[model samples]
Target: MINSNDYKIGRIMVGASDDDVRYVHEADNLPYYHIGSVNGISMVTIDVIGHEITHALVKKTAGLIYQYESGALNESIADIMGTMLERYMLPNNWNWTLGEDAVTIRDMRTPEIYSQPSRFEGPGWESPGNCPFPFLGNDYCWVHTNSGVMNKWFHLVSTGGTFNGQNVNAIGPHAAQQIVYWALANYLQSQSTYSDARWSTMAAARDIYGECSNEHRAVIAAWNAVNVISPVCPGSGGRIAAEQIENSAESIMKVYPNPATDFVTIQLFDPITTVDLQLYDMTGKVIKAWNTKESTITFATKGLVPGIYTLKAQTPKGIYTHKVIINQ
Candidate 1:
């Protein structure tokens, strides 16, 4: 049995002394996760850990909303990462489905699965009564509950992992998740809605990989399969500003699967035959450098430590900057 002192979930570690972590054994006949303190604060159940962890990861990265369109993105992403993490990390406890582990939470698969029945509900994903064009066909789905549709979309896109005659093998789940994450965290704007998810994800993929990259192509195809837009999804005024820069000079410098775990694949964004690349730590000391001539470049940052570092690549054209992080 897990105690206040000994339990662990995914990459999160905590002790009873910390108030952010707490569990109650008798609530609803099963212990679950609660947000703040130990008493009167709910329990931290297993899936609750998943959802909470998702929220934490997003907060750390995009710092996206806690409500509305950003909220929907927030909720859906939580389900996607939480479910995926449970499937990958705690295989023994994996359910491969959202909210199935909870009685109070809505089941993402069947919106009708829960009686409250709002499209924005968290437990079950029902079509939102009304949504913008991208989500217009939306079945008024509740944010957390309705998120099942998007979660399923992510699962389908990431893992060749799919349902209902779709090719989920668009990209590796590991790679796809990272692509979507970076897009949401960096590429997406504040006013983005549900439909913007696919665009945001694909933009990130293209930015990380090349526009001609297979991952970008696969992501676009997957979005098409779900009726999501290829570029940016349009909202009320008929269009949004999310656009992939054509011949983006930003594409000249590349980083793959950011939030990287191992070696980061850096490719030359421009064709500078004579160029020097340097990496520096926070103290402004040079740590890694490469001097060579090639339009395509990749780096094996294996020995690099985990933390924030800057990659500066200079060519006859001037200077290019890329921020890189290695995850331990």
Candidate 2:
């Protein structure tokens, strides 16, 4: 019997101090898993056990709503924890793929092979009601399909990779597992979105690894590759004269993907001979400065941490100041 104090589920304790919260016994023709065992001993593999147990933990903690993004999160958490458990149990032989014994259902390292979108590209994805795969067309909102995005996130955070032009430093699997667990138990709400998961995971990483640490930055990069735009970290506030700069700028200037990553485009109504663009952090630190003559400029957001930044554009016509949000 696992003691309640042996492990944690968010801020709450788990299992009973005197009783076993989980039971595994022999049964006949069970439906693989739904908090219970099956008839065949082959059905009780290590990966299967790990996956189901993680689900139990999730139920005890967040009781994650089993639909849409939240449902996908629940599933992704289970898969991630399960895979980690498999690695723990068989470190020499375990693989990053889910399922086992001639039945590999998903591969976390590269979900695109199975027609899953590892990157959550907002509205560019199919409608929530439509399944990208025809066989599971009836499944509401393609919860399983969407699980790939978070799965890939976990994979990249654990193994390290160059994704979407960002170099994610490897945090390794154990730290990755612990950070994910912390996020799931503490940061994620019942109906969290992909963006919410990004924020929650980053917050968890920041708490465990420190804000300036490489782990925190890697978490941000991993989510960014998956197109989960995160809000700025705390302390990005209290800028003097921030409003005055905005009021002086022309209204015709536009920046897209308001909460932006990769790059943000600056568009102008009138062509200018020379335009100077300067990006400032909350503390009035100039992060990126550009000088150009084009009416439209695409500014790269690489290496900038998540936060609200001030963009001051100086043109022959007028001085334009705009607020741009760079999400992880």
Q: Write the per-residue lDDT of candidate 1 for residues 196-241, one digit (tens) a residue.
A: 6766666566556645366776676566555454543243223323
CA displacement after TM-score superposition, residue 107 of candidate 1 (Å) = 5.3
Give candidate 1 misplaced runs (Cα > 4 Å). 1-43, 104-141, 161-170, 231-247, 250-328
* lDDT (CA) per prediction: 0.56, 0.67
Q: Give residue 116's error in model 2 in angstroms.
A: 1.6
What's every prediction's RMSD, in angstroms? 11.1, 16.0
